[model samples]
Target: MKKPLQKSKIPSNKVFVIKELREAYLDKYWHSHEEYQLNVILKGRGTRYIGDHMKPFKEGDLVLTGPNLPHVWRCDNAYFDPESRLETHDIVIYFPESFLGKDSLQKDEFEEIRKLLARADRGLEIKGHTNKVVIKMMKELVHRQGGASIIGLLEILNVLAHSTELEPITQIDYKNNYTAHEKDKISEILEYVLHNFKNKITLKEVAELANMSESAFSRYFKARVNKSFSDFLGDVRISNARKLLQDEDLNISQVCYESGFPTISNFNKQFKDRIGKTPMAYKKDVIDSL
Candidate 1:
């Protein structure tokens, strides 16, 4: 995700903001807000970074993020199509945890809701049948006001609270304490790595991009992303390899080289470690499923 260039502050009285992003602009560096956020991606596809987890995003994807969890939604170039005049319609609902009502928090009926929010510190992706229902409810919430908004939000949470297929975006311990400046630095670093992961990346090169000493960069990178620089690089390469493996034309060896692995053995180990399967097995599974 691209860094947030500016910070947005919502007043305590304001419950949430509905933003329609139609331009090719970076939302801002990762930062947390006082209120929880429920984001529905109405259109467009790109990458989403919530806390320390980064993954591709697509239309109709709904995510709920807890308060103070850093997140970013970077839309693709097509999302800013001037000819279509279609802006990325994102429905964002922000509310303090207190909005759930004091009594509701104490009741067993809302236990799932509380658990869902607590788990949201790592972020949660709504999927399957729950996603369909929640997306529809969010669409309705967009046109509603006041009491309707509250009811709509509760309904959405209720659905999530009962969802068995909800996927967490990151580990429970993922830290998201990013100052605005640190967030910008980290985004630049990530962008540089993504663009160059197909080739060898040196510590000096990355440190230069951040304009920091190698040691300083190492500490800062680990602190911001919750992984070492090399681990982060390898993860990016493996993610791309997973995408390339879907193409039958690319054999295991081809994938290893194309994804910038230094050797076939190393690639196999990393792929299995990250994806929980050997490259050959993964390819076979993909083919068999197809």
Candidate 2:
């Protein structure tokens, strides 16, 4: 059994964190904050974990995460290059639901934004034209200070409200149990899994990470995440495999191995079962569309 990582806390009043990542490392433990989050990737590529969903992400990716949704951005190895000092800049916006005013949604002017936020419970991706608009707004947010930041945030939300290209990231219920201790435990478990997913992960290993026995860990995990451990791991693997498949340079066999599946047959079966398409077919579709 491995030990769990510590949880990181964000201040409630802060709207965002704009940071530069200079290395390819796991940034934080799997944890959730009270405020809704919007993350815009300025540079670099990596995997992103939101709730039960795990997928590869790259430059120009803009994601809106609902409150208390556990997530992490796994940066690509190129970020660690010594000569490339671009810092892998990421602009993140965080705000409470009340920032828009409790009655904002009741008013006709904000009803659309309110509805959009509701749909963001599963996480949302702003792509194409919408992503461009949001990225511009995020840049503005970084420069604004004082009350202007609040106004900028409202405007960003307004733009998102009108955009029709926002895509939901996952279908899993985003309602997380609200408790400090529970969030801490969940964060620890997630961090452990992300660090060790490439290798064999067992119930006992995760159970120990959560400081519980196998049986207890199973019950607690199910209760907190609404899915079993194995299912979650499979989802992570498939998501990674999808990303690998997009790279035509990698053959199907290479993708299966890199994604942590031990066999091609098993990878194909799980990929089709979860994604509704065979791995080769999925790869072909992505290539053909591009």
Candidate 3:
């Protein structure tokens, strides 16, 4: 899809920019930029969108996005409440391909970094120990200046290059091919669904939102997203259900209703189908992992 290519705003005198951001809510716009980005969410929980991939992101989530990969980190609805005190904190670094110098990365010694950057084209979520190390370096980076900051970035990249804990956020074959008009239509549809998925959503409602007939919208969405509308809606509901299930205070029945499923039987069956586990089992896993 056609995304806004924002300039990284790396100063004319600087090799890169390392900054700390605190926002009422993370930017929810769907867009892309020409510079590579490394981000660590210091405080937030939300749905992360990387190209075609959709997943929940939480505090300490570390991700690297290569140039031109459309993405967004949308905060949960609670953060948007008018009287809410919720805000997000992040450490973000943005740089261009030339940060490694014109010919430096071409050398065999820099092969790993080059490959890492290439892999980042699909967006990477740094996990486990690698995330910890990179995040540590990133925190220290904001305090460094001049030569020190540049060196700090290189060291972080080096650690990332050799790390085996990177997870690809999107599929390898995924590509953006929609025009601005179509992208706008799909974005609006998703925005509506995302905001209102807690309640029942019908095909006619979303189809009308996209200004298309029910059948037309179904075909268009399936062709571009590679999933049927009902499947996508189920995925959205399941995602929210997964989040709700993590809270011990919420029972399965509550999770089912809160996530928009009409019945516990349907919720359990669909949850198992998509998550490969029952809600109770998944909740147990979350507790164990903690």
Candidate 4:
């Protein structure tokens, strides 16, 4: 059940590399690598999975991932529509922890950058105006080469180091051991839950999928995923409900039932608890932003 280990094909001569991805969607399976990653989504909205965290990601979403941290951005169903002509696009920058040399991060001049990189061990999301600045720098670097490209990366890291508009994306104590079998097992569970979350699910049912008794499955899942199965299912349902809420076609009750909550009252309670806003209010805010 282990997920694949994606060996990043960085050029041997380059200290860091940047690439632009334009496709129907990103790779499907969960994977990890040995390089730090800075990802900026230019055109896409979907579920983003990092470590044991899963949430929605849209355009302007900027995230920095520490080396060997597993991550993926799965595009929404609309993007795969034959008639929609939608495409997924993003800018990705990859560099090793010591890209600047073995002793560079230990130098006084790199103190801030070193700290920033260290915090990325839990993953970091660049936000607010800082996201804007870093995106611009990334764009510039995409078109530059040689010494200029390296300098651009330095500038981008410096800006990130000084920016306070950053949020940690993973748990404080999360560690990546890269257990392939367990990773694949969790990946399978995630895929099944995401696709079937709208239907009735029970602990016994999923336990069978993992080939364990309900009690054993519960402990195994909680230990590896850092959350109970019920909580994880609720999160998946709520995340999808948020997306459906933004659509003009669905009303509150429709979204509530469609998102797998058996009753509107239950959906309202869960929505408020998870999103910090009532469904209608959340919809209004998204519309206002538009």
Q: Name the regions of candidate 4 deviating beyond 4 angstroms.
A: 1-3, 80-84
Decoy 4 TM-score against native:
0.92
Question: 140-190 in candidate 1: lDDT tens per residue?
Answer: 877888878777778888888889978888877777677777767776776
- Of 1 and 3, the candidate ahead on TM-score is 3
Clashes of 3: 0
For every model shown, what is its TM-score relative to the native structure? 0.78, 0.82, 0.92, 0.92
Question: Which of the numbered candidates is closest to the native, going by highest lDDT?
Answer: 4
lDDT for every model? 0.76, 0.76, 0.86, 0.86
**What lDDT is reached at residue 17 by model 3?**
87
Pairs with backbone N, CA or C atoms under 3 Å apart (clashes), candidate 2: 15-94
Write down the lDDT that model 2 would get.
Answer: 0.76
State the TM-score for model 3.
0.92
After superposing all C-alphas onto the true structure, candidate 1 shows an RMSD in angstroms of: 4.0
- Order of quality (TM-score): 4, 3, 2, 1
Residue 166, model 3: lDDT of: 96
Stretches off by above 4 angstroms in model 1 are 1-6, 9-13, 20-29, 75-89, 100-111, 247-266, 287-290
